[model samples]
Target: MKRVDVAYVLLVDEHEENVLLVKNKGPGASYYTLPGGAVERGETLEEAAIREVKEETGLDVQLGGIFSVGEAFFEERGHHTIFFTFTGKIIGGEINISLPEEIEEVTWMNLQQAEPYIHISNEFEGAIDSKTTVPYMLRDAGRYRS
Candidate 1:
């Protein structure tokens, strides 16, 4: 399987009561996720995170500590993906979707109201609540492959 590296961020408000999320335009438009994407070649994890957030949500962010590192292998896609998530603070720029076709909406939500839309990390259940969320990473992902 081809290896893919993905980077994401958890952008929290100064009060820590809200989060910035994006609703993708395609199949999963209904569900909301943190603003981030895949890491490009030669780009550092932090660079990718900053670039993705700008592209997806039009926000400039100041990244904090590494929040988590994980891997997910998808047999169907023939992909082994390594993901990294970091805590980020919005430094500037207005919130908007640069790629309308790929991203439908960008909005800030009350942490309490975002629970249902956020995908929680199972391995880190304690860290997977509404107030703090990491993208859902698959487990034993490619086991079905023969």
Candidate 2:
């Protein structure tokens, strides 16, 4: 059976129309994205989001609500990730890049500006434009290959 991992993608507030994004450092370093990580064994998705935000960016964020849920699979990498997208309110903490291994720099971009930088998954693209809360399931075509 394939392993499944749960994670959150946080849209951190930056004033009115903008949100904070983090540039990833390692493998998927080319794209800019939200603060998130895998959900730990004993923690809930919400708890993981809060913990990941603080650990990665040194920011305290109050999760406003869940925006969407989606599955991402990279066949060549042999990984499948389930993502929970959430809207977060920045309550406190200075913007600091704490996780050097996973993140490069932190940036604040308006929602419109962020469109170009985002690595689009059909799930994410739909959620951004839709009014309904949708759960997306993505499967790798090579999931059963050896």
Candidate 3:
């Protein structure tokens, strides 16, 4: 069995037409993605999200609630990642490029505009489009199923 990991976040400024996204740094980095990272040992999923956002963007946020959850499997790497998506509100801090070593750029974009830049995982895309909250699953490199 492959190892599993968790990545979740509180998406700030979601009320606005556009939400913030980050361009990753280093090789194999995707086009753009929400600010989040792997859950650390002994930490809650919510804590991981909060820490990741701060580490990646230097923005402090208050977690609103869980928006969704999904599973993704990286076949080539033999890893299965389960993500908990949460809504968040920006409580403090300004947008500053803090983790330049890990993040290349940060930008706010409308959903439609973000589509092109987002690392297209059907699971993530479906979560954005769904009318009701649902768990989106991505396997290999295909559309979200179930």
Best-fitting candidate, scored by lDDT: 1
Best by TM-score: 1
State each model's CA lDDT, in order.
0.77, 0.69, 0.69
Candidate 1 local lDDT, 1-146, one digit each (tens): 99999888888777777778898876743668788889888677778999999999888998877666778889999999987878888889998777988888888898766644445455545463434444443355555587
- Between candidates 1 and 2, the one scoring higher on TM-score is 1
Candidate 2 Cα misplacement greater than 4 A, ranges: 12-15, 116-146
| Model 2 per-residue lDDT tens digits across residues 76-101 | 77878777777677888988988787
Collision pairs in model 1: none
Give candidate 1's error at residue 131 in angstroms: 9.4
Q: On a 0 to 1 TM-score scale, where does candidate 1 land against the true structure?
A: 0.78
Question: Would you list the rank order by TM-score, best first?
Answer: 1, 3, 2
How do the predictions measure up, each by TM-score? 0.78, 0.74, 0.74
Candidate 2 at residue 45, lDDT? 75
Q: Could you tally the backbone clashes for each prediction?
A: 0, 0, 0
